[model samples]
Target: MSTPAAPALDSLDLALLQALADHPRVGDLELSRLLSVARATVQGRLRRLGEAGVIRGWSPELSAAAAGFDVAAFVSLEIAQGALDTVRDELLAIPGVVEAFVTTGTSDVLCRIAAASHAGLQGVLLDLNRSTSVVRSTSVMVLSTLIEPRLLPLLATTAAGREARAPAYR
Candidate 1:
């Protein structure tokens, strides 16, 4: 299915979003100064934008590698026809399966798994392959994560716009 079109944003909104992207924790006063808008206007815009669902709440990014989860691997799965549901459920139940996506490629499911060591990852891979519903799985261990950023460029723009609309409190 096609993605829904995003609402049009004015230049001011775009500027606000960009500013927020650069610094999510930036207060309304600072944002107001940066965007050259009144603090009250910034607060109002931010509230409106959030209510519209354009700006979701912020979250912190954690590093799995630094937190003792050194092993990272992508498991590509091919499940038996009519067994997709069962396979998906079983995979989700497995601990350390961080993310899973049902896709239209050679693999029916793509999963990102993290473990403390290579041995731990091996165990998970073996368990997946042994499942009757899973016809086959290809595991690719991550040697290194080259590009994983906390924020995307579009999000910065969106957040700035939303913050710009936050209500100004005297």
Candidate 2:
């Protein structure tokens, strides 16, 4: 069966999420004060959001470049038929591989890798090319990041839409 749809977020839920996003380290009391909601409401909403898988984690985001991995590249792999699981397992063993996805069209798998130097990047490429499951591969180095990863803007837009649809009395 297909998965059930996630419950829709009201304006208050959106506001709470925005508050948390802005101040990830802020406590429930502060959040309640900022949103003009009860502390219990903040706690209950956070609990519910966490339970629903909306709030995945509170971990700090790390920068690969700051950690000595200065070079980044996107590698697309064409794997042997029925070898996706095997390839996935093998990729997990590679330290430089940050993210990977099974995709459509020309490539079967797409991976983002980080390395300390061009030589290190070459070594990682050699490792991928050595894999028996990988039939072909293509890659491109990232020159610069134009936009940093973000979610607050999208959340704000969602909140605005929800508010616009609400009845005047509420």
Backbone-clash count (model 1): 22
Q: Tens-digit lDDT track for model 2 on 107-148?
A: 999999999999999999998988899999999999999898
lDDT of 1 by residue, 31-72 (tens): 999999999989988887676667777776567878998999
Query: What TM-score would every model get versus the actual structure?
Result: 0.70, 0.90
What C-alpha lDDT, on a 0 to 100 scale, does residue 75 get in candidate 2?
99
Q: For model 2, what is the alpha-carbon lDDT of residue 56? A: 81
Tell me the deviation in Å of residue 71 in model 1.
1.4
